[model samples]
Target: MAFSSPELNFHKNIGFLAFLPLKTKTSISLISGKVVALEILYRMVYNSLTAFGGQHHERIRYEQSLADAKKAGLRKGLYLGISQAFVNISLYGAVALIFWYGPYLARIECWNYDAGVVMIIFTSCLFATNSISMFIPYIVAFIDAAVAGAKVFAVIDRKSPIDYTNHTNNQPHVVRGDIELRNVTFNYPARKEKKPVNYLLFSFYIIHLESL
Candidate 1:
């Protein structure tokens, strides 16, 4: 199957996440959406500053994030699928029992104890089988998350990019505030796009992007 088929509706599970139709206490329709977007922006900035929590590159980290999100969604879908599968299997198994055992039980000489025993066994099996199935995904997910979290932590634990400068040898030469960076070019990842070389002129820096 082509897993990457047509796009899926984002609101299937999270449909009720927004009550656009229902009368909202707030005036704005996108109030909740806007808040969420802003939160994400701040979180990204925080991650960039404090930790390597975010993927780093010329926006390649963004693709890593998208991959993680996609993988997570796939795993969640798989877990739910597993749960549903177990439920259906249990139902079908019980029906088969009904067809094969129910009639036979009815004809039993002393049916009370035998019928009770059968039900208990079936119920026990139902819960046990489904419980194991459910637990498997959680255990796997936990392990996967732990590994991912470790990698993320490792990134954050890295040495600081800039160390403190010793001003001893560095006599503060009066800067004319004239900054000149020659032959500066930023080659952004993957794409053919070229980024403008960053320049900061203290007093007045005349920047002519010959690159553009």
Candidate 2:
């Protein structure tokens, strides 16, 4: 349930952090599913509030999520919500009916029951369940946030299979709109890259070679 600063970031291959724990859905489901969702949402809002934040980026994220949702239409979430509500209402209604009618039915010959006792016992559970309902959404929210955070964190945690090997030179390299790739093979990452492009925007120095 506790993640140190470095544990939050698994990008670097650290040594002796054996206590860091291996990646598992257990903790994420147990803790993050309840609390980390809120953390993710709040962090998202905070990030958006930062100076260079842009709504367009968030919108893009949302749209992509929608697209993915559409693609993975196997799951029915709205249906699940409706079903949950109905089940809760039905269960509560049945309990209420039992407590209400149990007294009348008890008066029947040899039908012995304590309606008051049942009501008191169930009432406590009802109240407790109701109280828990208040936190359920927050838990789900945290779960959602954790998923979002995890996606980003997972991306950040990725490693480049193709190292900057075959550098061809030891000095810093630069690209000034002019370079050549003939029979020379280069495999660009269409997706799966750990660091953000912005990080690379200014990292290089200069290159005598130019790209057409």
Q: Cα miss at 64, model 2 (Å)? A: 13
lDDT of 2 by residue, 1-212 (tens): 01121221231122112212222232333432333344346756776433566546655554553443443232334433543464365446645765666566656633455666566656765665455334422333444455558668988989876556757636456647543333433332322333233322222225553332
User: What is the alpha-carbon lDDT of model 2 when measured against the actual structure?
Assistant: 0.43
After superposition, candidate 1 runs with Cα above 4 Å error: 1-68, 71-83, 90-99, 102-113, 149-212
lDDT by residue (78-170, candidate 1, tens digit) is 555654554455545654665467447746745453666666755665555444434433443444455447547998899774544754554
Candidate closest to the true structure, highest TM-score: 2
Q: After superposing candidate 2, which stretches have Cα over 4 Å from the reference? A: 1-77, 80-84, 97-115, 160-212
Minimum summed lDDT over a 10-residue window in model 2 is located at 11-20
